[model samples]
Target: MPAGRLVLRRAAMLFAALALVAVGVADGTGSAVTTKPFLPDAKFDYQIGGGYPPASGVRVVSRDVKDVPAGLGYDICYVNGFQTQPDENGADGQPLEGTSTWFAADASRKQLLLPNPTPEYPTSTENQRYSTPYYVDPGWPDEIIVDLRTRANRTTLAAIVGKQIQACADKKFDAVEVDNLDSFTRAYATLADRTSAREGTEPEEGAPTLMSKNDALAFAALLIAKAHSLGLAIAQKNTAELEGEGKAAGFDLAVVEECGATTECADYAEVWGGNWVDIEYTASGFSKACTSVKSTISVVRRDQDVTKQGSTGYVYAEC
Candidate 1:
């Protein structure tokens, strides 16, 4: 081809490339590769009981989202991704038998409550025994509830959580909250105990189970993707560790439990920006959390039970 013709062809190709780049920028290509924003609203409510049409004048209510509530302004979905609920008789009852492949106890001697001792906190239950099934190998199905790291687990979680997101959409909720993001840390003890037992070592008295942080991040990424696809906003339950792992985890806001009780409030505030709502279950905790983050973050207090509206021990307050 002639030099002039070649130059013209090159120019056309360059123009086409530029056009594509412009289109991507205009339509969110950079956004596709970047993290989502964390926006905490000023006025908020945290209600997970009595099926969601929470008391009057409440603007936000965190719920299971799987069952969307009627006339809810904002909905945060709850998912037990970390620990498994015990079956009849717990270990003696085969708590996780059908659902989990992971279960181990040295000598088959059953202990009521498994022990968990973290530096800042300890498992509240002195006899908290979970069905041994969820304690099985993390790789196996039914071992852990959420299994955020496994593709299979992620798929299952997404489906269920997705339903909640859809419910939020259906109910016209402003966002979706996912609980148990911090279960990885919470389950660490139980998981360690299982690992020891599998290796023929005697299981510790009350070890907690641990989830793979990498896997959890991957799972959150997928969940975020689904949420964004559905045009629904997502919440970071309580996993402060993921603050630096990249925000593609589909979080737009945060709902922290006992932030006052735990030192994690500051971490959540830093990561989620100024848009977060914290719940304090104790009077001391509520006062501290509100005093500390009230100016920058929204804070509230609810009775520990977080019971249904007319329940005996219902308590709710806001600061």
Candidate 2:
């Protein structure tokens, strides 16, 4: 072969090889190629229960999936993916006329219920249970955890939570924020008594199952895949410990709660960079976060309940 022709042929082969490698990379990681929307470093709001006017400069909002998105900016629909919300009447209150089925059930086919322990409004009935299948968090009796440990339960969860993600897309929201990714961590703490008692024994016939971190990660990945399929990006809500796993599971951004108060803001900042938003519940937390690197990471302080502006307890501030 002519020397020039031989060199040209080799160059062509190298270019083709590189093209194949690019294709493989794109296929192997959807996050690399998918155009998921991200949070902007603009005024932000986290109003899950009540709707409010966007403060001056507001450009991003996170509201309950059932609520309408802010008309002016990127909106994130919040879904409680790992636990059942309190009945429509409110936590530990009467279940709505036809909403009891929303809660999950345990192995014995019995609906698991947790007590509501709000100090100001403790439940009148100590044994009252919510309509959920997963074990309830002892510390937060209002939330009944969902079972993410087994495939069957995860499938069921997918059906339940996947609809919410779809709803977000249907509403034209930019992203879906799935909360309680760390419920598995709380499961260990809340289920310690039952797990310790049965450590060496055969499991009881209808005992509650506690999910491991891996179980939660797998379930999150399932939800992320579903959200992406619907053309909606997903956010990793809180759970700084799982930031890496959240990224691996295909979460596009983060809606972190109290990361600055807990000193875990840096971890999430590193993972999502400008794609993350943090909310602090206290004045001191807001101050601390504003002085740290998080000041540049889109931090805000809001009332714990995230009420609306006219509500008595409503609070909102930005770094």
Candidate 3:
């Protein structure tokens, strides 16, 4: 063989050998990890508020942590991972059973750190209370944000929330949808700035600050590892900005709300590759999503409350 031809042949052989080794390494690492469940391109229902008999042709459904699976199709159990749900019992006003309690304490760890009293506004409602340790989100006054900055807090959260994901698997659900991944973004500083900008008022002071994006990511990674260990596929709920980080942290799919209305349907779709389920609350939003590239993204329109079918204000549509 010619010297030039011989040299080219050796180079080609070396490249092939390196390629084989790379493939072997990839297979070893990938196969050892649990594969995410396949999210079918079929009709899906987001019934987080309350469960109802799935409409005909619905192949997937997501319901609150307390609700049982629909038992007809793929089910995703929804768990509020980043914050505490409202106190179930109005009398005692205690945290919901089997969930994390959000209690802030001083550096001495003896006294509770109380939230500053929120000034009464014209729009304040009966259920909206401002004098508590919890920092009430502007729109969602019920959810008490949990602190995810400290390692101790994150560990406690993993123990409390990880059990919920485990329960989803125990209940035989197809996947788990961990909500409030972006709660950290709603921290005091960000919320105060946003609220002031929108309402044309001075920024609120004395708001308690908690988690950062990195903190949220770390907490999510813990939950994802726990979910995979239990053989359950976990989803990244909303928070389009963290989709890439969530994917890297082992989230299987995306559960997005109002992405279509916000013109962010393509963001989740790009990350999940049509493996996302988007729910828009308005008819116009649904229609717009249907016409966009998200047409094939399992887009649905549901009432803001997401009430069950046959109930008053029940609304559901699909693209």
Candidate 4:
């Protein structure tokens, strides 16, 4: 064998490896998985409720994981990645039992679920007695947190979400947006989120679940890897604080909600550049976001519910 031939063979192998990375394949290590990233600053819309023919020139749209995508340009399938879906209950208001049984605190008591505490059930006594499985977001009671405290749990969740991503791919969506990336801040904040949320009263027993930013980031890696392997880009929803880690974990874009309202647009912009989209729900926030980054980033003002164009409160303004 000649040295020149050996060098050519090695170079070919290297180029092949790089090509593999570009097409999105994952080996579990964050380094190997990469996707063809979506272009930055496209006209965008967030329509999680239901699909509609997108507005003229809209290049990106976000929809619920279960719903059909808008099919305009780059569709993002939205999944409640770090939390239980709000609609996970039977019509009777009890947790569903079959395939979607996200766990419950029954006599068996092995499932990782807390109570949906309220004024009457502040102590989680009645809520638990009724087997109401939840440790919900303070702002959105129906949205509950999932346990990402262990490797098994994280793997389980990743598989669950991976199926949702597969559905998006099956429908030909361009991307997936795993929402509630910041759920851990509430799930683990017993001192601040638990006690304080309960009117400064003593927190109930088993009040807080063991979810942390580290768990969320680790979990994001699983989702990112799964998305990339499917040749679909993944969005880092909210949690601008985790933007740096999320980017390193192979997140392809950012789907920010109220960054202008929270004054954290810069945090996301710093890492994602203009490859991020912002949805503002308030007039003031819309003004700020449009005034600041609209020239470079994709910014839109939408109704709080992201109502369809025909809905009464529907509002869509791009800046």
Q: What CA root-mean-square deviation does each model show from the true structure?
A: 14.5, 12.8, 11.5, 10.3
Candidate 1, number of clashes: 22
lDDT of 1 at 271: 60
Q: After superposition, how far is residue 288 of candidate 2 from its true place, in Å?
A: 1.3
The number of the candidate with the highest lDDT is: 4
Clash count, one per candidate: 22, 5, 0, 0
146-210, model 4: which lDDT tens digit per residue? 66777787887788778888888788787898878877665534435464543434334335545
Q: What are the models' TM-scores?
A: 0.63, 0.74, 0.76, 0.77
Query: Highest TM-score among the candidates is held by which one?
Result: 4
Model 3 lDDT on a 0 to 1 scale: 0.63
lDDT of each: 0.51, 0.63, 0.63, 0.67
The whole-model C-alpha lDDT of candidate 1 against the native structure comes to: 0.51
Model 2, range 104-190, lDDT digits (tens) per residue?
333332323232223233222222344122345444455566666578778767777787888888888878988777766554322
lDDT of 1 by residue, 220-301 (tens): 7766676665556666776665664534444666677777776566766666556567888889888887877776666777
Instruction: Kindly indicate the candidate among 3 and 4 with the higher lDDT.
Output: 4
The ten-residue window of minimal lDDT in model 3 covers 1-10
